[model samples]
Target chain A: MARLNVNPTRMELLNLKTRTKSAKRGHKLLKDKQDGLMKTFMEIVKEAKSLRKEVEEKLSKAFKNFMQASSMMTPEVLESALLYPSAKVELEVKTKNVMSVYIPYFNLKQEGDILNYGYLQTSGELDISLSAFQELFPSLIKLAEIEKQAERLAAELETTRRRVNALEHKLIPDLEDTLKFITMKLDEAERATKVGTMRVKAMIEAAEAAEAAEAAAAV
Target chain B: MKNNYSIAIVGNKETILGFKALGLKTFNANTTEETVKILFELKKQEIVVDEKTGETKPEYAIIFVTEDLAMGISKDDYKKLSQQALPAIVPVPGSKGATNYGIRRIGQIVEQAVGSDIFKE
Candidate 1:
């Protein structure tokens, strides 16, 4: 029965060596990418954790303030005050690319009842709070964007890690082993050829010496 | 091909427990003989052979083995398992071990970023 055999050329071995080196380098880089991505991800996770807590606190505060405001003012009066015709708010949302990912940006314009309400028409505190909420909206959007980015990076990191491991542990090692096997076989062949050549040269020299001795003896 | 598959880890008790937390099935192999036995059992469980066609049917995607246990298996055994294409033998970092592998990988990525080389387009 014929068994499978591998015959690798010198050039092929060299190519494999280069490939192995490249694979090793690639493996290292992918690992780094994974780590960097993880670092960024962890940072984002931390930020998100803290931001979520802060947002929850702020929202609670805002709700409490709304309750206080509602309790202090009669519902009908407050409704009538808030019923004033205000400016309409128009929002423009756009996307910007960062590190090969798209993130959103928003621009807002206020027109109708939003601009004409009693709070908008008189007291600046509610208007300030409204603007604060508007600012918070962008931050929340940004948080969501970062969270999405972190998730994508985590997945990419995992994939990269797997590829790097495959190359490092399996493919490159296999190539190197094959290359070594071929190189050793080639070296053995060369050694055998060298020994054969040396023997042939010695035999030729011995034959020439014998012929010279025979000639001397004949003379 | 069915994408759903599971990973099982074989190692020390603590390591196995840690892996179990990660939702992986685990078996403990404290001794070298037990490790070999576990590996053999894992290999047996990993693939089912078709009696009629004499073909092997593979199961599982990967199996993580501790480095110590990994040394007990023969190269031929490793080769046989590799040929199956399922249950890729991955030597994961042990519980007490430093994340040198992860750190090295990260370093490589950083190097690639700085050099902008190593990857072919």
Candidate 2:
């Protein structure tokens, strides 16, 4: 619907042709990028789903034990029992590019026993909950990592989709239209110039013929 | 000073108190506002590292929250947080029981990524 305002000249036509070619190439590349981003995003989504399901199941089991422990023991005792955690975790985070999106990687290093409290003071329920949490460390980290990846991929996918749409729907069409307009204008100009040159030639030939005829008559 | 990387648990005092025994840092946020604020804080809570490439990256790896508190977060905030890879915010059932919020979120993610709810629970 929109076009560049410029005189339709050979130079302009040449430039527009090159621009159209580049735009088409750019469109194809962007479309490929969008497809790649979608593929990656879907993979991450699948992984995140399974990971979340497993982690939720385990965590719920742990919470159930915590509930039982709380019911059996006094609130004050439960609080005192888990006052200081027995385990220490060191987490290292890094990012890697998946398609141009940088997604995070979480690595957890856990040290020492997760059961930090004295057995005499804690119930079996407490033990179960603590162990369940300990077992969940890796899943939790993995969930974090995958979820971030999904987010990044999703974001990239959106951007790529926007670009692809712009090229497919807007830029490419505009360029093509502009190219057509310029070519039509240039052809019309060429036709008009050719017609004018033909008319001049015919007139010159007619005048020469008349002069020659006059010379013969004079002779 | 204790460790460069630590896991933080945010939720009700009753629900997350047990996590303290594991040496994890715990924050009690009873209200939605407080929970969102804590999530934001945790999100922003990262250690900046100077890479050899001269780029700085902030690192804070994992965060766990009770499902009830996680639900308290607004949809937009939850979407933003869940999509992030760092400071992974995991939702555990509180003393009450499993709310299935975590699973549902995953299902939603599947739908968003694949354009269909194929991974329905």
Candidate 3:
């Protein structure tokens, strides 16, 4: 820790003491913030992981069905089949602040069923895949929300942790070092002054005694 | 706060149809350039805030990209896009099998914060 370059005066010492107090207070607050951010970040990470696993499983299953359905039909026919979407998945995003991080929440308004394609040449697997996707859409959106939350929270947590570390390791110690150095300097100066005054008094008394002895010898 | 953001998916005709059936706006991206272009376009949306309610929101909330297409986005762009507030870009399984890109990307995020690859063990 580097000593702060300030004049070693009583005024400077008092100012340093106040600064050290506030730095410690700020450090405590930052440490608490770090803990709070960590706790929130952990919760969000766990939720994101589970939700991600579920979404991945559902997506792969849906993709499998899609693969099968696409294999049975020609490219042109498959392209023409799902060209136009039947229903709409209405969405509105809302966000909540978690430890200063804005995490989004999606409100889905599910409308009619997805049945725009005629049931003629389409394979049953296509229907199954489309329905699977339809059902999983909301979950997908939920996954997005949680994952994004995790990302944002993690970032905030990182910054808070770094700040806490700087206070705990660097700034606080530096302040303490500066405070100690100033107090020591002030104490040394005080002692030096005391010694100098005592010597002066002794010399003056010695001179007076010499004059008194001179007077006695003259008498 | 309330927002008018929507989710989107970008991929080929076959891969995106499933998402379209679910009512997400699906974009057909034949090449990596097309996919990246679409993502940039989505990111270009300006955030709108209501003067009366003080509620703020953006247009695109999330964009799901197929892994094959996601692979085309440079690491820099991917990092930049993921680090933003709105429009969380995520990758999912397409017609092919699992790629684990999404899991790995999220793992990177976790590692960046926690200072360890806790996702693996």
lDDT of 2 by residue, B1-121 (tens): 3235677888887777767766678899887789889888777765545545564333456777788878878879976775655566777777666788877776666565455678675
Off by over 4 Å in 1: A1-6, A28-32, A56-139, A205-219, B1-121
In terms of lDDT, the poorest run of 10 residues in model 3 chain A is A82-91
Give the runs in model 2 whose Cα sits over 4 Å from its true position.
A207-219, B1-4, B48-59, B75-85, B107-121
Which whole-number lDDT from 0 to 100 does residue A108 have in model 1?
35
Interface RMSD of each: 20.0, 2.5, 1.5
Sorting all predicted structures by DockQ, with the top scorer first, yields 3, 2, 1
lDDT of 1 by residue, A2-32 (tens): 2114566687777778877888888887777
Question: How do the residues A28-97 of candidate 3 rate in per-residue lDDT, one tens digit apiece?
Answer: 9878877787788778787877888888898888988888888888877777877777676656877788
Chain B alone, candidate 3, TM-score of 0.82
Q: Deviation in angstroms for A165 in model 3?
A: 0.9
Candidate whose DockQ is highest: 3
Q: Is the docking of candidate 3 incorrect, acceptable, medium or high quality?
A: medium
Q: What C-alpha lDDT values do all the predictions have? A: 0.53, 0.76, 0.81
**Candidate 3 local distance difference test against the native:** 0.81
Candidate chain B TM-scores, in order: 0.62, 0.82, 0.82
lDDT of 2 by residue, A144-179 (tens): 778767766766776677778898889888878888
- The residue pairs found clashing in candidate 3 are none
